[model samples]
Target: MLSWPDELTTELRHDLFGWCELWSVPTLADEVTVAVSRRLTSSLGRANYRHQRVTLQHTLLHPMAAALLREVLCHELAHLAAYRLHGTKIRPHGREWKALLIAAQYPPNVTYAAESLPACFAVHKRFRRPPARRSSWARLTQWIAGIPCAVR
Candidate 1:
């Protein structure tokens, strides 16, 4: 079974609280939950609005991925935030989520740029941006499902 590092969990909770405060949803902080998943092969993180939980891919725990960890976590958390604020009717990455990302100072991009990521971050294989790239049809399906264009 996979588990989260105690220190990292604590830090993430602190960040979660900070985000809630920033978004003026302090009570939502306590309602939020975090989990780590080794089974997440393609995505970096996921948010379940109905459950108020954020699950992170274990790779974000890697030392080299430190810089991206917060961004990805907040990205998922923003989904929860949007849902908490707007109900289930909003688009996953639509204006509301994009506004939250902007408020958090992250680009509203759906996926991280391969060239800008750390080399060991597994941009190609894990994010599904193979050297040759995937078929346009594949990209469209993933996008329609709210998956990142490059990451599942």
Candidate 2:
């Protein structure tokens, strides 16, 4: 886990404000916190917290190239922007995310290259159900072990 540089945070905040301006929405408060942690075992990053309340968390465990970080930041910021504008009606990673992604200057269809981690791997499947809440920890452990995990 690595802390985002101050300059990078400033740039992202500035770009977010610019996006708000473009959409005619109020500028978001500058209180959002970006945290990186090794605890995350899913994808490269995740955005947590919304509803114009607290600092958003962006957790990145494995190494992310600079380009990947850009996408992740924009992707997370889009969630913040979407919640501010459309509340809970907006689908995550759907149209709203895509629009805000582009507005934040990432390519609309940006795809991160699979990061190489000797200790990590991915599962590929369709119709995989969400893990039962009670078994989440076990599931996560399985994932961390490089197993191809699916909830169901």
Candidate that would win on TM-score: 1
Q: Against the unseen true structure, what C-alpha lDDT does each candidate score?
A: 0.63, 0.46
lDDT of 1 by residue, 1-152 (tens): 22334637567667777887887777777777777776654556677766677777665676655656787778888878877788767777778877887888877776533232111112234335422465534432343244434233
Please give the lDDT score for candidate 1.
Answer: 0.63
Clashing residue pairs in candidate 1 are none
Give the alpha carbon lDDT tens digit for every residue of 1-152 in model 2.
22344535556556555765765554553544555544544543445544333122122212333444555555555666666777756555557666876666665553322233211123333212326563444443433334232111
**Deviation from native of the Cα of residue 134 in model 2, angstroms:** 30
Kindly report which residue stretches of model 2 are placed more than 4 angstroms away from their true locations once superposed: 1-26, 50-64, 110-152
TM-score of 2: 0.52
- Collision count of model 2: 0
